[model samples]
Target: KIKEEINKRIKEKIKGILPGLLEEEIEKITSAKEEELKKGVERIIEDYQPLKEENKIITKLFRLLGDKTAYAAEKKPVEKTKIEIEIEWIELFNPYEVPCEVEGWQIKTSLGTRALGGIISSDSYRFIFNMVIRMPGKSIGKEILGDNGDTVILTNKRRNIVDKVSYRGYGLPWSAWEKNDPRSREFASILPGGSPGFRNWFWMPEVGEAKNKNDYSSFYVKDKPFANTGEIVFIHSGEWRTIRLEQGGEWQILDKITVADPPEKPVQGRININTASKQVLEALPGIDSALSQAIINYGNSKKRPFNEIGEILQILLLARLGSNGKDDDKDGYTDEEDEREAIFRGLSNLITTRSNCFTVISRGEVVKNDEIVAERKIKAVIDRGSSPIKIKYYRELSED
Candidate 1:
């Protein structure tokens, strides 16, 4: 039946041939175009409902026909949908000499919105941490200040926006980057880290020459063999030690005495209090072996790591207030309030609760009829410490 139908259709297609053509010439032309006729027959059979009634006959007929032509309709190229996210910017533009209280201000990020407290001193910057802005029970580093990229929005107490900024995490931490500047955010020459609470290190501090003789003189006097009255100086014995001149102006150095070196020079850069080891913590000023161990203990005992630098004071206060010189969780302070405060204040600028880098993975897909037709994934390493943020590394990923 299929063969009869195909032959009838081919004859109908040949009916318009010129009258000059003989029967044999028409037969030759029809035979030469048999393949073309087959394709047309196949399409017609598929479209004709009556021909589709019998699945077996349809299948047999298609087998008799040739494979599809290259010109046949090709599947539509895979198209991916675009994803958009809302972002807000933050900027402070106060020129008043007096400090402005930012209490009740709000910071909105991709993760969520966080309220601000405390004052932003005139001509100074305040670095707020995720712990202060994130909702309770949220993780510190990943929640608000997205390690990969994020939009930051600042609103005043009246809910009016002050400023906003968007950044893609990429360059090294501590390096300065300005939006208007043509320079790249990633600086290969500078090491990782940044000046968060202060100005960028690229600028030099304005220092004037000493105006008075006293200002030019060194705090410690040298070249004088005999110590002056009420003078304190370092004496070299078996080990360097400090000696004071009494009322008689006489100073004696201890023989074969061992002493630790004086405090190290102040170092730049901040350490993540959430991840630093006890040994690393001890390297900071006012943090001795005992205090370092207390910090570690406090960090471990808590459900989460330190969310802000100020939280370290709670541990220091507990250590200072504990009885018998043992670390404890005592609630009140004693005569050691000043000492504890000194320790906390010393570390305020040297510690951070979040990491400098973050990894972000994003996947995109094209879907049809509830099934994924095409997919692509990307992995990026973002450096949040840089002023404008940087993408340290990026690569396309695949699913095995």
Candidate 2:
């Protein structure tokens, strides 16, 4: 009777404490939350016969512990940013296909992103934007917002979603992409330090905003802003129209394009390769009448002829063996496009497609009462056909 009573008490104790113990054990083993733990506990009890002493409830319970525990807290998933800044209504555009309507909308991008453009690489160049920016209601020169990792937002009085652009350049690089619907580009394919914003490529102001160019010219002029350098008239061999400067900055037809080299001397003499006849070509040192005719014929043959002086040299080199009928690129341009395109047009050297000025030098003696007193001469590009016959320069010459 004593053994029977003891066994009965033990059984009662196991039944009473075992449920609570199982709950605690399951909770510890599985990092599951309250709901998931409850479900798991019910499953274990239903599948294993807990009341039978001979059953492998303990063994099965141990096996359940090995079924991947979920004791650690769950990490929340990151969601995409839902801002209304990207616009994609237009069919085709630049950089990003769609343009943003930023009239009242204020931007929040790095200051470095405002204006950026230059030689993107040795092989190609990129042009962006150049602006003297001002905020509404702000003073002319007053400074405003836009630093790295700053939030760029556009909102009206109601705080309604107008538009927004945000970037994090405190770390890697990214590209500013415009699409109809936006999605974060996978970083796996992006290069380190890649920036994807208009104004935040390198975040150093050097890479420039996706919109600004440093204003380089293949052949630049003097006493003028970089903008004044005129366009080169590239005559296509096959077409009868001039190719735009926007079309041949890469010079796919010309093997190696050269820029405004070493800056033309301020008072330097420039010969228009396009209009210069055979005689004028002979006037330039190292050029003969044969090369001059070649230049003229090359220009006359194309619709938009000789947009670049480099093209002139290039064609001269190609025609060295004298017209082999070897049309490499099949684009009609055989040589120089004149002075319109400089590989830095307005930075230093000056060449032009048009010649409104002519430098004339008249050698004569300044005589005093018939005896030659002094020798004098002047070199200046005459401002020809103006209201007055303008003599461009006047100076004393050494008459020895």
Best by TM-score: 1
- The TM-score values for the models, in the order shown, are 0.25, 0.23
| Candidate 1 per-residue lDDT over residues 1-400, each given as its tens digit | 4335444433333332223435775566456445644554454334233323333232121111222111111123222211111111123433334477999999888788878788877556554432111111221123556656666678889999766666665544422222211111222113222333333322211111223454532233334432111122323222222332221222222112212132232222568888888768866644667777887888889869876554665653333522345222122333322222333423544566778777899999999999999999999999876667889999999775
The candidate maximizing lDDT is: 1
Which lDDT values do the candidates have, in the order given?
Answer: 0.45, 0.33
Which residue ranges in model 2 land beyond 4 Å of their true spot?
Answer: 1-81, 84-123, 127-354, 366-373, 398-400
Provide C-alpha RMSD values for all models, in order.
34.2, 25.2
Question: With candidate 2 superimposed using the best TM-score fit, by how many Å does residue 45's alpha carbon deviate from the native?
Answer: 41
Candidate 1 regions with alpha-carbon error over 4 angstroms: 1-269, 274-307, 316-318, 321-335, 341-346, 354-356
State the displacement of the C-alpha of residue 284, model 1, in Å, after optimal TM-score superposition: 6.0
Q: Give the per-residue lDDT digits (tens) of candidate 2, residues 1-400.
A: 2122222332333223223335444333223223432343343233222233442121111121122111111112211211111111111112221233333323224442222222233212232211121211221121223323444454433446544544444343322222211122111113321222222221111111111133322221223222222222223332233333323343343322323343332223455666676766654432455655766777777767666544554443323322344322222322233322322221112333556576677776788898987777655667754656677666655554
- Our model 2 lands, by Cα RMSD against the true structure, at 25.2
